[model samples]
Target chain A: MQKADALVPVSAYVARAALGRLAAEGSVKVSETEPDWAALVIRVRDHGDTQAFAALFRHFAPRVKAFLMKSGAGAALAEECAQDVMATLWQKAHLFDPARASVATWVFTIARNRRIDTLRKARRPEPEDLPWGPEPEPDQADAFELAEDTRRLGEALAQLPEKQRALIERAYFGDLSHTEIAAETGLPLGTIKSRIRLALDRLRQSMT
Target chain B: MTIRHHLTDALLMAYSAGQLPEAFSLVAATHISLCDECRARLSAFDAVGGTLIEDCDPAAMDEDSLTATLARLTGAPARPRQVDRPARGLFPAPLRDYVGGDLAAVKWRPVGLGVRQAILPTAPGGVARLLYIPAGQAVPDHGHRGTELTLVLQGAFRDESDRFGPGDLEVADQGVEHTPVAEADADCICLAATDAPLRFNSLLPRLAQPFLRM
Candidate 1:
């Protein structure tokens, strides 16, 4: 683990509030009208809520499949791998730290590791997990802020000029090696990097 | 120990994108295990991937995709969270996974001049190894053809470029050439990875290079 900061004190009050929300909406549905992904993951984590898992699967599975295909997997393999990624997601929901990563970000990591296994037949070494303390849930404000930051980052990525955006996409989509990425000239990655950097600082502060 | 040296954004981004060779990924993971700055930077890069996935054009799944996936989830349960262990030993978790234990478990082979190395298994394209340099001994003068990552784990070393202490990572490429000597205070143990064979400047090491598998 990295540096230990002040612990996030467990709050039974917040825990009951979360359970209250889950109880109030006895049968949740996947809808454009309600897309609180972190809350939905909490529902899945606390109670094995199939409705919430179904909603997450509906939203992320196809995107994961598309992500795999872009990395050069055939459609069938991509579909199979995407399902595995989602299954791993459900199995690892307790490990998801909404204060640290968006659900989309967490899903990307799962899909990326799956691609490494199925496509390249290689291992992906990961950093040690931070000890996130006894609380599985985070401060609601922290989770909400992280989601907002993720949304803003998506918009920023979309607004980049065509060439810059394409280069960035190519870098993430396995089109560029580290050497090529290092030698890439005039990349417009500075602004995007700073935006994400700020989000990380906020996350670190919230963890403290 | 505080780490002064860190991985470049290029390497971190490539790692975040899952594009590095296995050897390079191993070095990066070990360094991130020891360095928080790089860890935070890596998370930011992962955010970039997240954004890309979010904005990508959606491909429709088969009609039964969600149902099929739900059925697969039937007997699944959340993985039990790892028990929080206090950081206890020299090796971080990632390296421990490869070595299967801490410092006492490494199987070392003598290279020459009181230096030993142990190569870890990884997919081809690069090689990852642990190098042991006795206190006050120097590795042969050499240069690299491709990228080389050397991370200090147990002791300290210095070259013409800079001093690398525990958790410090030195990323050397084609233009960097130097001899690294272990500090006299203690024996130095490092985890090093190279993409291409090193170009030893002297005849003896050059001849021994093939057997060294460096």
Candidate 2:
């Protein structure tokens, strides 16, 4: 009886894995209503389309400024840094990998690096780039699913208890040290972590 | 190479948040360069950062900010997409960049025993160094005052708890004390970072600690 019970969960997990693979291969239709943040970046990269860049700037620049301000920059400095961050976004559009990260994630990384450079004056060593997939054109399904995953992650963050949510916000805002983060409230990171893991697995599959 | 141990979630989160000291960031970056698991995990934390940024209350930019940014973008060229290399040498790219090249680039100074170390330049509040332990040699026994992160770059080492091979990271804290010995077959090279000075158990190493900065 115990053997049967174990087999049931194993089979279910296998089924789920297969379904995920099928979805990643573009068999499943992602809703068309979902915003295609990658498309704007592609326009900026390939055509230097100011309209597309303007759209991205209008959405992300203010948030980037807010992020810098929270990290201890004065208003004028935050404004200047936010502009620099957006200008960098325009110049580094080619480096953005939609299949690997959502637009917001890419923008956040760029902003975070700028904050470090301007605020801390410290070097941030980045991981070596993994050899991307042989496909020159990113698969639309992969990009869509990754964006959707990040959107869901934002929702999950919103649903966490106030204390846990605040802790997470503080960590990102540069207020918490690793030791303090570890000692503080137990963040319910499992859901978001697993969701991101799923996105990574899809990208890894596409890479190979 | 198979990696057994990995960075803790707290470390990865701090790194993604850009809150870690530069020395620890160097160690974390070098380890992530070698370990794909941590790379994926780091991306997860970055995604959390993205979510936080998205949910932030907007602090409106000056009305001319977008126009000013676009003006700056007119003459600037986008950086060419980085081409991926097929194979890597002993040190990953981050460590290589720090050292200016591969294994040949490091300037080693003896720190007692057969071990040698070269401190990497980073901002204050922590220290990062490359450690070389001769085959079958033992590093001085030490306990951590804060956190100590050691990542194997080449060969393997065995401490009181377990073995660490290339790409493995051991995160030791204040509560732990151990002497790590290089495996007999090959010399071991590692990147280690600590926020506070290590507590050396032996008097000789203790005396030399200030000069060596370990």
> Which 10 consecutive residues of model 2 chain A have the lowest summed lDDT?
A1-10
- Per-residue lDDT for B92-180 in model 2, tens only? 88888889888888999998887899999887667888999999999765445788999999889999889999999999987786889
Q: Which digits, one per residue and each the tens of the lDDT, describe model 1 over residues B1-214? A: 8899999988998999998989999999999988767876677678788878877677777766766776676644565574767557888888888988888899999989999999998876678989999999997553457888999998899999799999999998877778899999999999999884533224544675697543
Candidate 1 chain B has its poorest 10 consecutive residues by lDDT at: B196-205
Model 1 accuracy (lDDT, Cα): 0.77
Name the docking class for model 2.
acceptable
Interface alpha-carbon RMSD, every candidate: 7.5, 11.7
RMSD (Å) of each candidate, 1 decimal: 9.7, 13.7
Q: DockQ for each of the predicted structures, in order?
A: 0.29, 0.27
* lDDT (Cα, tens digit) per residue for candidate 2, span A20-86: 5677898975455644668988877877766666667767899999999998899999999999998
Residue B45 Cα positional deviation in candidate 1, in Å, after optimal superposition? 0.6
Candidate 2 ranges with C-alpha deviation above 4 Å:
A1-35, A183-208, B75-87, B198-214
lDDT of 1 at B55: 72
